[model samples]
Target: MNAISSYLGSDHTRCDDFFIQAETNVSNGAWEQAEVSLAQFTEALERHFTMEEKVMFPEFEQATGSSAGPTAVMRMEHQQLRSIVALMRDALAARDAESYLGHSETLNTMMQQHNMKEESILYLMADRVLSGRQEEIISAMTSIDAPA
Candidate 1:
């Protein structure tokens, strides 16, 4: 299997599952559980994004002898995500279910968009540009822990 299919699939699966758990907690009005679940959800995102920004993206950029395209956009999206994520903590603290759900949906959309781009375009590019680090990239991501 290609790196995109072979690697990112598992990570995305777990992360998405966590997102659903967080959503459930919020839907049930379990603010405390939702808070913790959100934290765990964020951790999973951080772990995956960190691995990409630190390792895979750089390597792909280097391999292609350029760094001004897809990776840049991904970085920008990450910033947008962080901004929304910050608001989540406050919403959670206030037990503002509406606000919390809105933020969670925003985060979910961001992740879905980001993942779609990464898996469809970025990972394919990496599969082409990166020569020898397919397994390494995958392993790095796999080893990184989600929040809880």
Candidate 2:
């Protein structure tokens, strides 16, 4: 894997780990643990999105000179993911395991598809077009603060 793929893909895996932990906690009916795990998962995912939207996507768009391509699709998918997460949060607050699990399943599917597109396509193109600026982009992404 090239630098862009290596960095963002690793972050994706990290977010996946958190997602699994949250889902497992919910499955076990451990509401408190589920809350903590879900919070962690949300923070990690939001940070990943922020990194891509704030740093990587902008650089990729500028380098490629097009804003209506893959990055736009990713942004829209991010919004959908956020909406699902909000639903999951509401379920968690209501202590509705069935609702939470249903939303979690949907989230898992959406995330898998989203990550595949980014890892297989967008990241590959980014690695090619953003060559020689890998470190700079990575550095900028790293400097971004986690969502409040």
Tens digit per residue, CA lDDT, model 2, 15-115 = 99999999999999999999999999999999999999999999999999999999999999999999999999999999999999999999999999999
lDDT of 1: 0.79
Per-candidate TM-score against the hidden true structure: 0.88, 0.98
lDDT of 1 by residue, 18-131 (tens): 788888887899888887887887887788778778778787888888789999999999889878888887888888879978988888888888888888888887887764
Give candidate 1 regions above 4 Å deviation: 1-5, 143-148
User: Scored by CA lDDT, what does every candidate get?
Assistant: 0.79, 0.96
Best by lDDT: 2
Residue pairs in clash, model 1: none
| Whole-structure CA lDDT of model 2 | 0.96
Off by over 4 Å in 2: none
**What's each prediction's clash count?**
0, 0
Specify the highest-TM-score model's number: 2
